[model samples]
Target chain A: MQMLRKLSAGLLLLAVASFASTPAAEAAGQTLEIVKKRGHLKCGVSQGLPGFSTPDNRGNWTGIDVDFCKAVAAAIFNDADKVKFTPLSAKERFTAIQSGEVDIIARNTTWSMHRDTALGVDFPVVNYYDGQGFMVRADLGVRSARDLDGATLCTNQGTTTELNAADYFRSNGMQYEIVAFEKADESVAAYNSGRCDAYTTDHSALYAQKLKLSDPKAHIVLPEVISKEPLGPLVRQGDAAWNDLVRWTHYATVAAEEFGVTSKNISEMKSSSNPSIRRLMGQDGSFGDNLGLSKQWAVHIIRAVGNYGEIFERNVGVKTPLGIKRGVNALWTKGGLQYAPPIR
Target chain B: MQVLVLAAVLGAMAWLVGNVQSNLERQNINSGFGFLSERAGFGINQTLIAYTEDDSFGRVLAVGLLNTLLVSALGIFFATLLGFSLGVARLSRNWLISKIAMVYIEIFRNVPLLLQIMFWYFGVLRNLPSPRQAVSIGDAIFMSNRGFVVLWLEASAGAFWYGLAALGLVIGGIWLRRRAANAQITTGQATRVWRPLLGLAVALFGGAALMAGVPFALDVPHLKGFNFRGGLTVIPEFVALLLALSLYTAAFIAEIVRAGINSVSKGQREASAALGLPESVALRLVVIPQALRVIIPPLTSQYLNLTKNSSLAVAIAYPDIVSVLAGTTLSQVGQALEIIFITMMIYLSLSLLTSWAMNRYNQRMAFVGNNT
Candidate 1:
């Protein structure tokens, strides 16, 4: 009896050891397979940034970035609700994705050259065009980002914003002391206390923060686009096929917008003679076979989150309280920077 | 069985750490404390110690260590004062006072400290009026949205003179106490010790003033346009963190103190009373001295706990070691293996040092009580 129990215990321990060792034993091959077998895509997202990944009263998350993750779910499983949202702080998002705690990270992360090459992660597409800017109290009498010389700037730590703010100030031959915090809320409080002379972040975030402030009329974001912050989503490096699927989910949205297919109008536009739209919607043939998806993969994404422009306008763009106009985020046909490659 | 158990645990830990290291290194990630010598080149928000973006990472870690020690040390001092007072009051005869003390402990002990910290920070501290409309304690003091500001004396060389005089007074007090004790023992007459203590205090204070008064000047805080100009600024985040930590830890300390005081035999107070001692003297000269032996060991552990708990300062952005080293530096460098290892080692060393001091304290008290 004792021998049998001991044998079973030894077998259990070996199984556990093998489970733990599998990550490195076959990391590249098993990682992609494990994610597919799990069915639900685990995606890390921002903590309650209204236009990014904020949750509603019922704890159901909805935002532009949240929709991006949902669209990835739609493409993968033909189900929009198959994404599990992991709420992460600014510091934890990238690490969480890298450690395989999340299958992908759909947080409003910026795509930089250093991040592309050094971070060991793949940024799929520049879904949102953003720029670094500063917001200051109108009562402070400071006019532009240049006037922020010698000012104390409250920026969120663990971000490109910190380095960008520094470069912006330094390259402009101006000097400013940085007062960074991990959370956006803490930075807002410090800025609101007049402890800071300016608050710097992506320009859209400035508008969101101002709307939440006690005095909305009291602050104005300066008119300086300092750095090129091409905001996008990312996944862990390796698995070229998985990377393609995640990247093109974002591309599908932009492509749909360019093809004049809004979510409300997509089901009706299905019968059109446009060859590009037919190919994109998988209507012309089984175009998604090589990539391993339903023929209507692009249609599923559009139905899930609408087109790129619709998601933007609903969240942080002109229709929202932030009232930010799409300057560079507009479609390519409309003389903006958003241009996607051919679906076929 | 024990040998097998120990071997298995050790082997597992070694494998886990090795796995993490190999995985990190395989990604072309260089892993070592060698990064400490590299340029930090990143700015911090709320650093007390000297730091610059141009400083080395080792210098930045030192800054974090200093901030952690400062907050924890300050919390220990304040918590002791609050705890001891509440402990005594709970034992008081007055119902109202004891009830109030009981309420204080119960309220603080039950509520989550993080929530309390947030409440104090956002609800109370954030509502403080702007600097120009600051409340003044006196002409020399101001309180506002930023924090309290008091008139500080900028001592010239006289500060050194004052420090020397104060040291002399402490030595003088010791000598006087010894003399008084000798007179009581040998001559069977009590010599007073208060007058000499007073004389030493005044002489030291006066000499420091008359000597070189360390180039003293007070830069009293002034309410400027939208901010305070002149006096030292203590931000609300730090104040809230300290307040929440001290109050939360004090509730636990008060319970420890009460348990210690109750553990002392009633016979101690009875014996002192039979010798015609007054209540205050009986408690202070007899009960307190005995109860302290029971009190200190647990109280030392509470102090250590408070120190560890202060790492939660990351939630409030206080720039403690956890926030700066573990959160910011680890994320920026992505050297989790090295960063977390260094952090754990620092905390372990701190804890071991604390336990060593507590053990020495226990030994001294054991000798003093049992031998008598």
Candidate 2:
């Protein structure tokens, strides 16, 4: 009986110990604190989307999205390289963030009502504004999307592009068939191999994917924008501090652009008399400290990834293979929608 | 002591469930089956049922389930047919025939099913001519990279009566066969049943067709804008997925069949021969029934594997349950936990149904008690 009591006591202790660990596991949702403890930020990115997030031969990732994650890493660790990227598909991206498999999702995910309200993740800011469009072979003679009646379209499954095409065709009273593949490259290859009459996706993505086709010059993107796809970074919900940190990381780049602060001249401009510049450069009030970071958070972000304009130009601008233009993604000062609040 | 273990297990389950609930609540994520009624604002390329973008998520699940069932049922049918043939050929007297069967079994069974699916979809089907230059069979059927387009029969309202008439013919045939067997048992006089039944069936079907004014109209496919319209299209994804699934499962089924045939006692075959039966009749009457006892349980497992592997349809965009419901709908609704749980339940139900059917067949084939 004494030995039985000892055994029961041991079992009880084990149960109690497991119960005690639940709260610690619950606190794992505090993403910023966990990142600080782990020393490296886990950023979810695309499998391989050019001009967004694509790794090179040596596994070095480069894109506007990649730069955004680097900026976040710099803010937290003060080192741009302290980031581990988890490549995810469209179907897997939300689950990865919701399950806490990644600290942030820097993949090119569209911000939508259903996702914002229903998904367990929060889209803090729009990094790139994209729109759905169609690309058809040059020989098809289909000038407008309206002429695509009775056509077969290829696109990636589990994306807004599929729904957008369906809605666009249905509302226009035009009958069309969609052949969606799980991977973006499969859809592009299908379109290239003449399995589909056209390929539809984000306009910017169409340009990037066209380069991978057998004859890149043979396809033309239709001059039609179907849906508003404000692609942005996402973080798990229930952590307002982490949400603010990610939101401000994006705004910091835009504000730096508005203040005419490039990575090359940011250090020299620190001595400027401009009040906005002084506040943004961390020469004024403790803005970063309020978010539990050093006062020079914005400085680290800008120095690591440059302003938004520089990141865009270096990765997907006019000189790049994608050659995307900053139409609505430009700063509000230049007649665009990108506007940032005052740092102070 | 057993009660204590059971209580501990139940308590652990309760804790896990509570943990998930609290976590989801904390994140403000909606968790329930309510999202199933919401609109599924997406289009599936291939659907066995009438589906549109305006359909609810519930309808999408139905469409996906039907597609999965279609592929799995057809895959099983073809795999069984090919597997039995190859198993027999493997035991052929001719050396080249047996070697050919061996080669086929080795080549297909050793390679991954996913690679085979990709090979058929990308390497073979995609290389077919474009729709503009599609190979046409008198214009009623076309083969192209897009898919195989065939002229199909469009049934009018009268087709229902014709279908009922066919069902009646089947029932009549079964009754006639049973009566013939009874006659042979009681009076020792054989009765010819099939010829009369065949004649009656033809007459009944013809009369029904005449009364229903021939209910089927030929729907021919023609090149419209970019695709063939007004006909049945066998999309390449389905064809590729079906081919890969059948060929891969057929290889394993062939081995199962071979082992079953070998397990039948040599004495059974010799006894049927001593009764002056032909080799084919002896094999079918004496050997097969006994071999089936060994073949069934493993064959059931192979069927389950084939059904589960159909989930790989997503890789080739076949619009099966995993692709349509779990991939697109879950992503759109952002209800991962609920959607995944539902999908798991669906697969479990399908597997259980398959196992139950196979067990019924096995019971019917088993020998009647100790008489053996």
Query: Considering every candidate listed, which one attains the maximal DockQ?
Result: 2
Clashing pairs in 1: B155-B214, B156-B214, B156-B215, B157-B214, B158-B213, B158-B214
Cα miss at A238, model 1 (Å)?
A: 2.1
Instruction: Give per-residue CA lDDT, model 1, range B153-250, as digits (tens).
Output: 76666578878888999999999999999989999998899998998899888887787755577887775544566666676667888898999999
The lowest-lDDT stretch of 10 consecutive residues in candidate 2 chain B is B363-372
Candidate 2: CAPRI quality band: medium
- Tens digit of lDDT per residue, candidate 2, span B92-179? 8899999999999999999999999999999999999988899999988899998999999999999988898889899999999999
State each candidate's clash count. Answer: 6, 0
Candidate 1 — what's its lDDT?
A: 0.80
DockQ of each: 0.35, 0.56
Task: Give me the displacement of residue A338 in model 2, in angstroms.
Answer: 1.3
Model 1 per-residue lDDT tens digits across residues A1-344:
65665565566558657756654543473444675688888889988778888888999998888999898888877788998899987778766766678888878889877566655578888878899899998987888777777666787877778777866776787666676678988889778866577889998778878877779899999999898888888876665777888878888888889888998998788998999898888888775676677788889889988898998898877778878788888887888999989877
